[model samples]
Target: MAADEGLTGSSRVTVFAMFGVAFGYATHHLDARRVGDVAVVGPLTPGVEWGLLWQMARNCGRATAGEAELARWVLTQATRAFVCGSGRIAQFPEQGWKLEPGGKRVRFDSTYANRDQLWTGNLTVEGLAPDQVAQRPTIYTV
Candidate 1:
């Protein structure tokens, strides 16, 4: 129904949830968990599917609220660290990065001179403050 309400493309339903859950009620600073252990219900993968989820939320008339905005930001960072190959896959399979348990990071991709394999065993967002980090991470892997 959201597509009729202006939703389309990959993971439209997931996008809708971003807005629906974020806007439907008051969300606290929660959802801290492991990346590998976390599995999205649909065909969508973590990190990559987040933007789509946000778009779906917009379609469903949900604005980025509470931790929603932070969630979006985290999604971007995750893409940089994992999907884009900036954190761990940087330098062509030589360097690597790891996020330890209970780790809270503001940024990951550009903390060093080279990109390394980014790994997060267990971590929580702990919530993001009102800040915008740099975007435009290079895609070194599929």
Candidate 2:
């Protein structure tokens, strides 16, 4: 969890990855937005630092329902849509996504999630050992 804390505490590269993007749609699905809830991206609302809302989530020792919802959307809908959108480009130099020239998509996603169901897309190698998989399994066991 050290790496997770480090990245969450401070990670310029992660922030840099979100630098430029132009989408007409509003964040957090718009309708879901409420007082003290600021959406950073589609269905992704980052709890404000030092805010009461964030404090509650922190004190609870897990993401609030809103954050969990956003996380679900991120791993499933958001990331799935994003990866599928690369239908015309090369994900890696060796692998092209074009439908022609024998380019095919295996529909794979490498995102890490607490619950296996959260990653609702095709399967591909994510560079994780069997025991290492699901490293952050959901805290609840219902």
Give one digit per residue, the lDDT tens place, for model 1 in 10-94: 1101111222121100111113531122211111222232234334424443354533333344344434434444332112212
Model 2 scores a TM of 0.21
Task: Flag clash pairs in model 2.
Answer: none
What is the lDDT for 135 in model 2? 20
CA deviation > 4 Å runs, candidate 1: 1-65, 89-142
Q: What is the lDDT of residue 82 in candidate 1?
A: 44
C-alpha lDDT values of all predictions: 0.24, 0.22
Tens-digit lDDT string for candidate 2 (1-142):
0011110111000110111111111111113342212112111112212122223324444444554443344333223333454211112212111011111111113323322222111112212233322222234321
lDDT at residue 74 of model 2 (Cα atoms): 38
Judge candidate 2 against the unseen true structure and give its global Cα lDDT, from 0 to 1: 0.22
